[model samples]
Target: MQSYDVRRLSEIAYDADNGVTAELSVVVPLYNYADVVIEALNSVVEQDLTAVSAIVVDDASTDRGGEQAARFLAQHSERFATARVVRHHRNQGLSMARNSGIAWSSEPYLFMLDADNRLRSPALSRLLAALQCSGAAFGYSQLRWFGEEDGIGVADVWDPARLSTGNYIDAMALIRRDALLAAGGYATLADDHGWEDYDLWCRFAELGFDGVFLPELLCEYRVHGASMLRSRTNDHFDALMAEMRLRHPALLCSSVVGVNP
Candidate 1:
């Protein structure tokens, strides 16, 4: 996790006069995906928004992926308003990684881009527009799956009722900074690693916040053997769902427990 100025997550802060200013912050949480992280960075640079910054959170990756991403951002500095890589002292889960990104972010909007995924087109402008005009908490679009899996990911207009069944919205969405902060960001559920996004949305629903769905496919979701969902066990899934239902009783019910996503 080396950078031009590598700082632990605890040490990084948003300095308004530090030459990094933006309307949106793109947070890419890096794990062990060294091979494809550069592609993700490239996609961020290709975004159709100029008043945007990029933050890549390195969760103490064992590989050199974090370093590679930092170097890539440095090499393409002109593409973004500002770009930098932040490091964690140890391997935290995805939720904490995103939380670190949120802490370092100083923008009105935020977008979560997984290290392995890529945007198919210039999406920031359209998603930002949808979020701005609809007065929604966030904006999400249909995802076109690629890699080991090839198809369109399940997507639907924002429906708070459907959240009790399962999460249909992916993490790759443009969200209002204030709304996300008010919801307390993503949660880190013990033994329920991959459901943070669902939990956040459920919290939003409880807070009476909803997202605007854009039907156009704007991003590519990479599915492979290493996907977090693939490694989850049936027992873990049941426990995770039950925990979610318990935590979000207002939005979830006993009938929704053990429901697979």
Candidate 2:
């Protein structure tokens, strides 16, 4: 998939020797979620790791969400090793928005946070530690669901064998930049209402990269009617699954379209 040019609004200098060593780039892709984009940015600013950098990609949001995010990040620029607000000239899909952020980041690791979600703890340090020690493609933790849904979203160890069934991990994870780029980043499927993360994980498994799971609730996911999962109808769901099967035939069997997968 092709990526487009983005306008850079705010940028903070990176000073590694002075304790501003940027290792992880928190990529927050914002669409029209103006109301909560700041919350997501705030979570990034609050990360305990001084090595944290941030890239907020505003995908041509009409709701002025991009401006809001730029303002917020500009206010807290000093808190990050490197902070940037990249705005897409037009509205690209979620995958491309993330790709834009990835293109702009200079860090070794990445963490994707939706605009409506927030980090519950100083989880980046722990996730970075796990990834460093395990040499995994990515590291994920349990998520706490809120808003329309309230509960703990559990995660499991990455198992390629289980991919044929369905995606068990969320997009909210700490990932290696090299592994992500090697996988060609997130797929921009025409039928993708969601499941981009699933496609990426399948590619990772195909590349012999595994994910490390940390059993801590480090992030909160807000579920609402406008959320991708809530908007996906049965037909939409089927079409996306069909696309997944076609793209990753080795990872997804016929069972992927069945009720079990």
What CA root-mean-square deviation does each model show from the true structure?
Answer: 4.1, 3.4
Q: What overall lDDT goes with each candidate model?
A: 0.80, 0.80
- Candidate 1, residues 1-261: lDDT per residue as tens digits? 121122344443222233756888889998899999999989888877866788888888889888788778767777778676777888878988888888776788999999999886678889988988989999999998888868887889999898777788888999998888798778889774578888888899899997999999998888888775456567577778778878998788865643322
- For candidate 1, give the lDDT: 0.80
Error of 2 at 20 (Å): 3.2
User: Which residue pairs in candidate 1 collide?
Assistant: none
Instruction: Give the alpha carbon lDDT tens digit for every residue of 1-261 in model 2.
Output: 232233243232222222477888899988899998888888877878866788888787899887787777667777877777777777778888888788887789999999999986678999999999999889999888888888887567778888888787888999998888788888888775767888888899889998999888998888898876577678677778888889888778688743211
- Estimate TM-scores for all models: 0.91, 0.91
Single out the weakest 10-residue window by summed lDDT for candidate 2: 9-18
The total of clashing pairs for model 2 equals 1
lDDT score for residue 219 of model 2: 84
- In model 1, which regions exceed 4 Å deviation? 1-20, 257-261
